[model samples]
Target: MSDTARTIGVVGAGSIGATVCADLVLHGFRVVLVDRDPAALERARRVVAEAVRFGPMLRPGLPRVGAAEALAGVTTYTALEALGGCEFVVENVSEEWETKRAVYRELDRVLPAGVGIGVNTSSIGIGRLAAETGRPELVVGIHFMNPAYLKEAVEVMRGAETSEACMAYVMGLLADLGKEGIVVGDFPGFVSNRISHLFFNEAARLVEEEGVEPAVIDQIFKRCFGHRMGPLETADLIGLDTVLLTLDSLHESYRDDRFKASAHLRALVADGRLGRKTGAGFHAYGLPAGGTGAAQG
Candidate 1:
């Protein structure tokens, strides 16, 4: 697709949303990012700029672009109507049903007919979200991990009514961004979160019940399992609040106690220790949260 024809909309300005915006910009796609919070938009912008500027240092194969040029490629807006002109949109709103439902309703009204939407969710089913719009065939689940620019693959969920054409289009788009799509069913939590959240919750339980040091628990997983990042470390990176929210969602959808969140996890959010974003959660951090088009939803 022509760069002009490929203008994409990204909704939400949280960790994942900002990171996705950067990945799009890095791959030379102009973006329109929307969020209710102005502060988040600003933060997301910084994220894109920094991710672009320093991207080449981490991976020599990455294209190096100045912050100004990279930042110039994206537009951040508070109004959802700004997305009307986008050819495709990636929805990364909060994991709450009502919040996502409201966004889908607006997206249905704003986007042109036949424009596909990528629902970047944790546990919500693609079918449920697609049902909110008149065009179920165009909605698909596109779950991206945090710090998206570094990820080489994404979980692509195909809903009951998701069209083959839409699937092809999204796969092509991911390829353009230097990533692959692993298609899966419309099951709640799909594959990643349904399984990963268990590790996070159980890790927290171990900490609370057994009094195991968080670092030691994480070390065991990393050393013994050959995992890149441990459960506790990942929880902090994803923001403990987000992990807990996702765990709650899985529990509600499955009604399984296995998805039940640890009480310690709940208490951390209540105490305002939200992980790296808040400078503390499972571990304390030294840096402040900052990134922006003007970015974070």
Candidate 2:
């Protein structure tokens, strides 16, 4: 596909999707971001605007759009029809198989023949989703990390029936978007998540089993492992619900002991102490002047 002719449609404008769309727009690709929630679309626009302001430094010569017109190249829509003309469609919906399958079925109805469709699912089976799409050749997994702008790795998962041509196109697209796309098998918890989850799951176990304080464990990991952000802090950024959902899906799919959802993490989510989004999880954060104390849970 020619750079000038590239147009990507993104379904769901949450953090990861929004970040991906912004990065794509910066690369001069026309984008249409779809979301059901008006508030979410607005929030994504603000995120894009901030990234645009820091442009060129992030990607040389990329658009440095102002707040008002930050989302100009990208269009927002609530209906799937608006995505009809896009060359590639990326679905960044919730991590539920049913939700993702529903989205793909709808996308299959809308996308033109031969157009590429990518799922940003972390732990779901790409083969199953590909079969669900009916157009198995066009469907592939392009699992991007949170804070997509900063993360250079994108896991490219192909189903058993996925064509070599489709894989080539996806890798080329990833390269064009300034990312390194590594091909992997159709398994639960593709490369990044498989490794990253070890950090999070073990961290949770340490806190629960060894009587380790959350703060102390976080500090130890950060200092000892030379990690910039500890597992809990990363979880805070990733949203507690997402972390739980990923764990549940991986555990169910693989039935692996290592993928067991941590009891403490599940409790935190159940009590609505959803990390940074809720202003507290393992730690408390405050708004500029006056934010409340250790957020209720």
Candidate 3:
């Protein structure tokens, strides 16, 4: 696809969506970020402004747009119809199936038939979502890591009805965005999530079953496996709610006992220890490193 034909629309302007938009703009693609919440839209605009001011991924000496002008090329819309002419649309909503279905249905009704739709779901079934869109041929799964712009690996999934042209378009697009599109099936918890969850689940099991401290487990993984962050720390950064939801989705899909969400995770959620967002999780914040007496959340 031509660079000018790469007008993209993002349905969620949260962290991931905003990162993607900033990256797209730096790569010369017109982008529109859509969200129902004005606060989310404002956040997206601010993120874009920061990225532009710093020449996000661009050369250090290059001129960058200011806050007001950085968002000029990127429009924020609350209505789905605003995505009508976009060549690609990415959904970044929560993990709920019904919420995604509603967004897909709305996009399918207003978006041009030639436009492609992608979802950022970490564990949901791509085929199921495609079916709900009523345009399976144009629906594909493009999973970018949490920090979308900085991450180079992207999980690209194809549904049963996905067309070859659509796949080619998506792969080519990912390449343009400097990403490695690792193609996977429509199975729930596709490659990365399936493999990574084992590490995270094992970490949780250590805390719940063996009485191992969360910091100790995290330290072992980091020291032994060369992982930058331990599973618990990663979960804290990703939000406990998100981690539990992904695990639950995987469990429902594979019916595997291993994929089950850990009891410790549920307990943390119940106690509102939702990690950094809530001020506490496996470790207490604003304390001497590794203290775990529960700060707030």
Q: Choose the strongest candidate by lDDT.
A: 1
What is the per-residue lDDT of model 2 for residues 1-297, given as tens digits with 9 covering 90 to 100? 134647889998875787787778766677899998887777677667756665446555454555445466778988889999898898998889898888888888888889878889878888898887768988888998766766677989988888888899999988887888988988888887877887888888887888788888788778998887888878776777888899888889788879887898889889988776666776665531012221111
Q: How close is candidate 1 to the true structure, as a TM-score?
A: 0.95
Q: Candidates' lDDT values, in order? A: 0.87, 0.78, 0.77
- Highest-TM-score candidate: 1
Per-residue alpha-carbon lDDT of model 3 for 1-297, expressed as tens digits?
Answer: 233446889888764677677767756677888999988787677666666655443434333445565566688988888998788998888777788889888888999778889888879988898888768899999998755655667999888889999999989988887778999998888888898887787888889999999999888878998987888887876667777888988988889999888899889988998776556888766631112222111
Worst 10-residue lDDT window for candidate 1 reads: 288-297
> Model 2, residue 296: displacement in angstroms?
24
Cα-based TM-score, every candidate: 0.95, 0.88, 0.84
- Is candidate 1 or 2 superior in TM-score? 1
Model 3 TM-score, 2 decimals: 0.84
Error of 2 at 112 (Å): 0.8
What lDDT score goes with residue 160 in model 1?
A: 99
Could you list the CA RMSD of all candidates, in the order they appear?
2.8, 4.4, 5.4
Candidate 1: misplaced stretches above 4 Å? 1-5, 291-297
lDDT of 1 at 244: 83
Better of 1 and 2 by lDDT: 1
